[model samples]
Target: MTLTRQVVSFSVIGVCSGALTLVIYVMARDWWSPVVANLVALTAATLFNTEANRRLTFGTPRRRGLAHVQSAVLFAAHYALTSCALLGLGVLVPAPSRTLELTVLLTATLVGTVGRFLLLRGWVFKKAA
Candidate 1:
């Protein structure tokens, strides 16, 4: 697929994944702390996002070991940003409203999405020579 097409596909997937994460967090928050809920949501979305990007966005039909590793590293970076946002919210507001928490998470996720796209396109899923 062309780079443009790949980016478009990735963006669609990213939106779905972000929405999924929010839903997961909302459902999980009832039973788990915000941090733990976010963790679970991120983990679930990462697993699906990696495979979807590999097959649909990057057009890597065959399984590549390095891709999985790269995806994990990408998620780690994303998680770090998200965790910091959560931490900062806690510190800043002490008792931030639920809407505020969700807003912070969505913003963090969007920032991470930009970085993730760069790494996925320019590094992890680069075209073979």
Candidate 2:
């Protein structure tokens, strides 16, 4: 697929997954800590994101197992980035509001999204040559 198409598709999937993450985080936060809630949210979103990107963005749904493993690595990186942002916000604000926390996370996710796209295109979903 062309880079333009890939980007658009990936963005669409990412937006949907991000919304899912936020919804899950909000619900989970009522029962658990922010970190734990974030973890649960990311885990669920990652699974959906990886599969959607494989089929819709990259069109490489043939190797499901390998794609998932590779995406898991990507997920770990994203989780680290987002988690660090949240932690840093906590350190800075002491007791941040939900809006603040979500803002920080959204910013981190946006930054990570660029790297994720590159990795997905050049690494995870690279066409065999």
Candidate 3:
């Protein structure tokens, strides 16, 4: 697929995956700390996003073992960013509301999405130019 098409496909999948993450976060928010909730939600979403991006965004037919490693790395990177954001928010607000936490999560996720796509295109699912 063309690069443009791949981006569109990724965006589509991302929207779905992001919503899933948000739902999971909301569900677990009361029971868990924001960091823990974000980790759990993103872990599930990352699993789905990795495979979907592999097949749909990059259109690769063969499985590469490195893909799993790449996905794990991506998730770690994402988690770190969101975790830091949450930590910063806590420091700034002292006691943030759920809405604020959700807002930070969404913003952090967007930043991570951009980085994730770059890594997927340039490294994880690299194709001949």
Candidate 4:
């Protein structure tokens, strides 16, 4: 697939994943700490994102195991990025509103998405020689 197509697909998947993450995080937050909720959200979204990217974005449906393993590593990085954003928000504003927390998370996720696209293209889903 062309680079443009790959980017567009990745972005579309990312938006869906972001929405999923937000929904899960919001729902899970009622029962768990923010960090734990974030972890749960990220875990689910990352799995969805990885599978979607494997078949749709990169057009590589084989090697599901490797894809998931690599995606797990990426998931860890994303989790750290978003969790730090939430933690920093708490530090900056003790009692921040839910809207504010979501804003920070979305911003952090957006930044992370760019790097993710690069890694997905160049590393995880790259064609073997």
Highest-scoring model, lDDT: 2
**In terms of TM-score, how similar is model 4 to the real structure?**
0.97
TM-score of each: 0.94, 0.97, 0.95, 0.97
Error of 1 at 127 (Å): 1.7
Clashes of 3: 0
lDDT of 4 by residue, 63-129 (tens): 9999899888888898899999999998999999888988998999999999989998889998977
Instruction: Score each candidate by Cα lDDT.
Output: 0.91, 0.92, 0.91, 0.91
lDDT of 3 at 5: 98
Pitting candidate 1 against candidate 3, the one with the higher TM-score is: 3
User: What is candidate 1's CA lDDT for residue 44?
Assistant: 97
lDDT for model 2: 0.92
Which lDDT tens digits does candidate 2 get at residues 20-114?
99999999989988888999999999999999999999997569999999988998999999999998998999989999988998899999999
Candidate 3, residues 70-98: lDDT per residue as tens digits? Answer: 88998999999999999999999999999
Q: State each model's C-alpha RMSD to the native.
A: 1.2, 0.8, 1.3, 0.9
Model 2 clashing-pair count: 0
lDDT of 1 at 86: 91
Which stretches of candidate 3 lie above 4 Å from their native place?
A: none
Mark the 10 consecutive residues where model 4 has the least summed lDDT.
60-69
